[model samples]
Target chain A: MPNLYDLAYDLEKGLRESAEFQGLKQAYDAVMADEAAKQMFDNFRQTQIVLQQKQMQGEEITEEEIEQARKTVELVQQHPQISKLMEQEQHLNTVINDVSRIITKPLEELYSENS
Target chain B: MPNLYDLAYDLEKGLRESAEFQGLKQAYDAVMADEAAKQMFDNFRQTQIVLQQKQMQGEEITEEEIEQARKTVELVQQHPQISKLMEQEQHLNTVINDVSRIITKPLEELYSENS
Candidate 1:
């Protein structure tokens, strides 16, 4: 029998082979292949990271920053490749969410049984 | 500028550095270090995978199998190392859940803005 880590790696490989994941990878690659789209996505991601760090530190987000984020999001969403990437991400997230629940079912059953 | 995949890799690295993850790793190592515990855990995992596959195939599990699984979970839960591993897994899961939400916040914000 394979070890738990080995099983996890197998699961990862299975996910990579899944259509949803493949779609996501293709969409991501498309965005990266376009220099302008890549730049926009990177800027959006940097802004996202900064906001995340601030929120984690309990710092308030400013109105101006929020406006900037909104604009960046709008611009990115309007880009064909970036928009496709986000759509593919959502599709892959759905599959991942189902897999997560399925994987944890055994634990849920065990705990519920004993409790 | 770093790409989205690079940022994701950084997030993975950060998760590994977290105390919850560290605790989980130590607990996992403890269970794997004991030959008997490792054997028992592997058996439980194999049973789990079988049940998972059966369910995925739309087959109902036999009552006897359910009972067997219940007993195995109980036995493993009683094992010191296995129990510690489960406890640590819950802690790491909590951290992972939070990270999932945080990482998706950018998309969430963007969607909410347009909607």
Candidate 2:
């Protein structure tokens, strides 16, 4: 009789050990090593979060704001190291998403029944 | 600059430390301590996986199979410890889902733009 938490711990350990996550960590370290790039990324991330929060709250984002966001994304994507890190992030998130999907299947079933 | 992976690790640590997860672990341990309950839970889980897989593959589940699955759910719910564990699982998963949603906010924005 294995406790589910033991299995949960194993899953966490597996994710931490996965190559995708390791690559993400490496990219993150690279970004941290460069001050200019780090600042740029942080700024972009803050703006992104603010915009997302606005969207989530049903607040209307102006056309100017949308264009500004697009420009910030363009700038962020132009930085080689930062762009690479973003790519690695996308890859890592895909892995996490797969793991989450599998672990939450039971919850999905339960909720679907309720819905 | 704080690396994204460091933040990701923090999120994992937070989840592991959350009361919901701890409660789930406790309930899981309780179920595991009872041999008969553990066996029953395993059997139900196996059936659940098979049925889910079949549904995912677009195979029609017979009425009998549906009834069989319902019966198993009812039986599992009747077991106090197992029912409690299931409830804990639901709560823990809700916490995990919220964390995942927050972590993947940037990805959502990226994808929404592409779409």
Specify the highest-DockQ model's number.
Answer: 2
lDDT for residue A95 in candidate 1, whole number 0-100:
59
Name the docking class for model 2. incorrect
Each candidate's chain A: what TM-score? 0.85, 0.90
lDDT of 2 by residue, B1-115 (tens): 3344443444455555557766777787788778898888877887899998887655789999999999999999999999999999888767665555544544465434322
Task: For residues B1-115, write the lDDT of model 1, one tens digit per residue.
Answer: 2233333444444455556566777777787778899889888877999998887655789999999999999999999899999898887677556545544444464344322
Give the CA lDDT, 0 to 100, for residue A34 in model 2.
Answer: 89
User: Taking the tens digit of each residue's C-alpha lDDT, what string does model 1 give over A1-115?
Assistant: 2233333444454555556666777777777777888888889988999998887655789999999999999998998889999889887677556655544443354334322
Question: lDDT per residue, candidate 2, A1-115, as tens digits?
Answer: 3334444445555556667666777777788778898888888888899998887655789999999899989998999999999999888767666656554554465334322
- The Cα local distance difference test for each model comes to 0.68, 0.71
Q: Report the C-alpha displacement of residue A6, candidate 1, in angstroms.
A: 3.4
TM-score per candidate: 0.50, 0.53
lDDT of 2: 0.71
